[model samples]
Target: MTMRNCTLFYSFANYGLNKKGRRTGKATLIHSLRLKEQLELKQKYLNKSHELMRTKNEINVEWDSSLSHANLLDTPCGMVPLDTFTQAQRQQLLLDVVEPPLLSTVNTSDFGKIKSRAKYKLSDWIKNDSFCDAGIAFIKEILASEDVVNVQHSIYQFNLFDMKRKSQRTEQLVSYINAHNTLIDKPKTLNFTNFQEVLFKIPIVNGIGTDIVSGKEMMQTMKEFIVHFYPDYPIKLMLLHDDERLAHENTGAHVHAFISGQNALTGKYDLRIAQIKKVNEFLFKRDGMSATLFSETGRLNYEQAGDVAKHMQEMFYEFVNEHLFHPKNINAAFHPESVRKSEKRKQMRKEAKLAKRDRPFNYHTRLLEDVDSLEIKAKKLDDKISQREKVVDDLESKAAYLSENCETLIIKRDALEQQCIKQEAAFQQNQRRHSKKIRLEQEVDERLSTKRKEEKKLDESILLKQQKHTELDSAIAEKQSILDRLSVMATQALYPIQKMLEHMNNRLILKGRAGAAEFMQHIIKAFSADLPTELRKTLIKITNNTGDTELENALTRKDSQINDSFDM
Candidate 1:
């Protein structure tokens, strides 16, 4: 559809149907014009404020790696004062300031007098004229430079170096070294000024179970020891390279406490070891409770230690890891105030960048686009309001013409009402029939649901019977197998008895034949000798009867008669 038709149709459906189309369109057009004016005013205000807002941004300067010297701008630029240069130019100049030399000796001409007054060794003191003629000239150049002094504070702050605190610590350390120096017997002594050149090592005592302790736990324990035992001394405890406990690994979670006063003397502090043992005995009297310390000689010779300077450097790194290492950022607890402030500024800048990224569009960008779009929509709405007003006028004219035919229309409305009444009655009848059909369908559904439940129950019963039948069949099969085995066993048991009975029967028959024949022969011969002719004939008959079956029967009968005669 055309835009005009779509707008008109929406107007007719929403407003024309309620007979308020013209009024609503006029009100809408007025509101749109007001909105356009407000947006234009807002746009003007934003533009004025934007013009007034002046932001100064700094360009970050990065130092060049060439450490040789600053590339000073020649002639015109170099002649200007350092303050006249932009911040970027100044930062570049600052990079030219090289690190100061490690060994800057001060005058120690009265070392002997000072040592006598303090009653301490002055062996480690920097002797006068330690720095040759060239060193003095270099020192003079640094002291004379006006730019160096002017930027000295800024340079220190940038490097996060607290020079005041550093100086104080150095003095204290020097005194400590001199005091302990008198106690050492070594010919070659440690220089307190460069005590950082000394090597230090802490042992993991097998008895103390240090090998099994966590790095953090061991560090904390060492801190506690220093706090309790040497409350006056400042000690920095750290944990490094935790892998020493394993046979293959040469590192473990061992605590290394860098005691600042340990280098006060050149020789190993045997006295400190004794003190440590005393602390352990005081705190824990148990046998395996003491911590041990290894000699610096062993650690100094090890491959990892390499040299005293490198070992000290590693110790510094370990200190940094313990004190400054945070998961996402550096911990500034030990940092100087100036460095902490710089860190805060960097964090704020990061957060601002994140906020800018999250915004959908800047307010200024939205304002410019909204001003143009509002004016266009307002103009369109005005034109729509005029067209709708014309349509409303046309509708009003049609309504006036229809007003003249009102009576005639009212008569036809009554007739239509009567027809509507009849239709309503027919609809009610149909509704009642539908209700009855719905009721019948509901009854049928209920019956079907009940039948389904019965069918499910019957199926379950059938399954149960089948299961029982299977079990019974299994039981019967098992019993049948047992009976068959028993029958076989009974037959096996009866076979031996049957064989013995058969053997006895055969033996009895043989014995009966042999014995009967022998007895009949003996009786017949003896009787024939003792008897007369008639008696001998009878005996012969008996003897003849004993032959085979007939003789056996006659002899048996005669022996029975003889046995009967003996009883009489």
Candidate 2:
């Protein structure tokens, strides 16, 4: 055997087989332990790598609360709820939340109080429990510690009235209005037009052309503004309601205040328009409010004052109507300066004048003059009634015209309804078609996806089969090599036996004895004679030992001898 073959046989006998050529357990145990150790090392490495990586959600925010707290309130940043606000309002809210104005240290108690006889007070009022105190605190931290009230020629914009928090502000406003109309420390002189200004240390804010800021939110901001900037100034905040500009949904409502801080400090009206502009700018920057400041020149104008006074009166009247005060009280409160007195006042006057003599001698002469004037006034009243009747007839004709117009409107509304129905039907049809198209598309996509998956699996299986085929080819090649080596070994092992037989045959032939080869061939010929005739002839031809020269020459031919040696 070759050296490689000998070594391979020895290894198989020692490791894989026992003396009887049975497989041993020692090699199997060693392989199992090696595989287990490698698996353990791989698992350990995976665990170590897992600890080194982290996901995106692992990190946390620091100031997320302050930035997003506004979203939770009914009114965020003094505006309406985020969902209800317009794009402009939302933008303004974001600006306010991002960078709030500096808040002054104005206390809630310092807000203007009502001068009315009402027993209720603002400080003790409830319902506004969760006010904008947090927002106020935030603002206070940002503002510089400057005396805004006493600053020379500096006009401060005030947000004075918020209708949202109506606990005591409305009452206080009524009292303020009452004070303006009716003089204090004197008998009631309720001249609303003459009574122009009432001073109070308060700020007012109300929404105009928007419903973003509720009365409560406005109040919150107003209280904070007064506390911070207008604490030292006279809080003369007024509520002005423009009935003409009033919106059905509470828009176009604004608060007005006389610039009294500068008046208190200098005792002279500041004429600088720059101060008003600066105040407006500051208010816009701080709270996103466009605070319109009235200069002294504008304030003194009759038309402006009249308009403001009218709105103020309307605000007071609106409150009175809502609260349902007695007519006597209303007359006393609103028309106290009128010459006509109530029954009680007349009685008190009569009781006080009991000590004085009564003078009534001119009564008869006055009665005659009063009767003549009554007749003339009655004739004028008759003419006025005729004119009013004519106006009523005109109104009746207009009503008839409106009634006809209503019929046309109803027809138009029916046409619109029919059009809407048709549009709705078309929309539904389109929706169904779209849905069907989507479903078809989805089915097609699913089929394509399934096909792709099948193709991928087929490709993977083909690759695996190719790999296995290549490995089988290699194994077959290796087996073929082993088989070739084994064939060579077998040939080498049988060569000695063939040579020994040849030597033995040569010896026998030289001694003139029947050699084993010749004797075997004669025995084969004798056995063939007892077989079938055909078989006997074939065996005789092959085993014949004839001494003819031609046959001997054929057997001794070079090609024949070479073929015989190779076959052996």
Top candidate on lDDT is: 1
Per-residue lDDT over 1-568 for candidate 1, one digit per residue giving the tens place of the 0 to 100 score: 2111100000001111111332332222221112222222222223465435422110000111121121111122222222234545433322221111221122132332343443222122223335344434433443333231323442343234323344543443344335333322321122221110111123322222333333444345445544554454344212222322322222223333333333233333232333334434443433355633334332233543233323223333344335423321322122344853697645743553332212333222333343444334433533443364345335433432433232222322333343334334432443323553365456545645654565555554564455445545554445435433433333332232223222322332333345645544444334322232443344334333222354446544655565566579
Mark the regions of model 1 whose C-alpha exceeds 4 Å error after superposition.
1-110, 113-212, 243-251, 262-568
Best by TM-score: 1
Per-residue accuracy of model 2 over 1-568 as CA lDDT, tens digit each: 2211100000001111111111122212111112223222222222454335422211111111122212212232433322344445433433332221221113111221222332134333323344455433422332222222221111111123223555444444344334322222221211101111221111111222224333343334334433443343343222222221201224322232222322244322231222333444454564575544445343447765444443334333333323322221321023353432677645644543221112121222222333334334433533443364345335434433433233222332343344334333433433323553365456545645654565555554564455445545554445435434433333332232223223323432332334644544433233322233343333234322221233224323533444455579
lDDT of each: 0.33, 0.31
Query: In model 1, which range of ten residues has the least summed lDDT?
Result: 4-13
| Whole-model lDDT, model 2 | 0.31
TM-score versus the correct structure, for each prediction: 0.16, 0.14
Total clashing pairs for each candidate: 8, 25
